[model samples]
Target: MADETNNPDLEVNAASVSDGAYTLIIADFSDTDMAWEAYETLKSVEDGRSVEIEGVIVVRRTTEGRLEIQKATDHSTKSGLKWGVVGGIALGVIFPPSILGSAAVAGGAGAIVGKLRQRHHNHELEQKLENAITPGHSGLLALVSDPGEIKIRKALERAETIVESTLEQVEADDIKAAAKEVQGAHA
Candidate 1:
């Protein structure tokens, strides 16, 4: 059900990764620094062979309330498509459609997407995202083999708010494909 981390800074949190679906974890932190710290910690743990993470992304709402991807891995092309699937789905889910293009479609926060979503999904993941990382906060999004992985437990503990969801690979692929289509249209 859970895996413990030897690192004192982290602790076991919940179920580890799943087999038929991907476990996406979004953790909100008061500051971007903390979020980034957790991201690094996750990677470090994976490097030590303590766990396996498909991908990790750090997202933040700037002081202006715009959603921005502070850090993301693009290894889907280099390592394997599986490596970046989680992050891709996250960006596709959270980024407002206006931000997909050059303009915000509204007056404000030119650096990040400002909440005018072009499309919608039936799932409550959108609302969950809104609650997990409010404006001006930071978040860590990760896809782990198991949510119970010690490294995952430890990193997620750093977040002030955490939300966990499971999605079949096809669902995630749909999200990614949709996002890419939007990006392509903008391009």
Candidate 2:
């Protein structure tokens, strides 16, 4: 969900059999710049350490035939006008203040900005998915890992729940691998 991966047109794939490594497939289905982003967020639960839960981001083709490029700038913009102001003010420091200000401002004002950005990004992503979706073209994001049956199942279930409406369900094996070919073509 974080904008670390700019892949706007994401397709998540999580099958029970992919072992324990999360695999992300990014397909540039549009003529525009690859609009996709992906990154993992690690959390420390009560346990001593947690498994490195990974997130996969994939670009899918839409019915409208436009690549859903969730721009990085868009994400930052959604973060907030306040952060922009703070960032600008901090920039005035022209030194360590810029770096420190970023962290501090992001923590306070940036929090609101992050939430807004994420909310709008998700909304836009959904809209683009709806618009680009065609009968047979869809971008995909799959998170697969041999973490464990339980983990794998949970991941797959999560993906299924999110992708059910936007895309036609298919076995991971059945999901044709046009991503690489498509990406190469676009590149």
Candidate 3:
């Protein structure tokens, strides 16, 4: 949901980004196995470019064609506890509730999970994410910062399709608020 008014189209490259604290990269793999492999490879990705990978997650379509989070990590953040992309509600907003499609009702969290779709721009973002990862394909979402964006594309060479979006602090704060609401209800 990177302010659809300015850039209506989702871009494959985010070289235009400047001064922003974060760049969100979503890479779709040819197959589910490839995604898992890419996820492993990501851990060792370093090119001296200083592109910090803040958080990352690998998701694949389950047997029923629903998105399933296979692995997620926040890496370096927080005081001690690792931060995760999904640990907040960013990933939740990327995939619509229907795509989650199962006994997702884990009490109040389930109801709050659906709140992402309620936002207009999030729906468009969800549709884009859905389109990128077709049946049997998997997606790797990364929240990165600093320069050398190319390092990410190179590391994700196996990605069949890659899209990058700008995530400003304002939008991130909104996501955090949504996550807190969901957690508060769950608690």
- After superposition on all CA atoms, how large is the RMSD of candidate 2? 18.9
Pairs clashing within candidate 1: 15-148, 16-146, 16-147, 16-148, 17-145, 17-146, 17-147
Q: Write the per-residue lDDT of candidate 1 for residues 42-71, one digit (tens) a residue.
A: 766774244767667777766666666663
lDDT of 3 by residue, 24-115 (tens): 67777768777766666665673334555655677776656776666454353432212343333556655666666454222234445455
Cα lDDT listed for each candidate: 0.55, 0.27, 0.56
* Cα deviation of 137, candidate 1, in Å: 1.2
- Indicate whether candidate 2 or candidate 3 has the larger TM-score: 3
- TM-score for model 2? 0.23
Higher-scoring candidate on TM-score, 1 or 2:
1
- Find the candidate with the highest TM-score and give its number: 3
- In model 3, how large is the Cα lDDT of residue 62? 66
**Distance (Å) between predicted and true CA of 18, model 3?**
12
The runs of at least 3 residues in candidate 2 whose Cα sits more than 4 Å from the true structure, single-residue gaps closed, are 1-50, 58-60, 64-149, 158-187
Which of the two candidates, 1 or 2, achieves a greater lDDT against the reference? 1
Tell me the number of clashing residue pairs for each predicted model: 7, 32, 1
The 10-residue segment with the lowest total lDDT in model 3: 78-87
Top of the candidates by lDDT: 3
Candidate 3 clashes between residue pairs 3 or more apart in a chain or in different chains: 74-83
Model 1: residues with Cα > 4 Å off, grouped in runs: 1-20, 47-50, 71-86, 94-120, 173-187
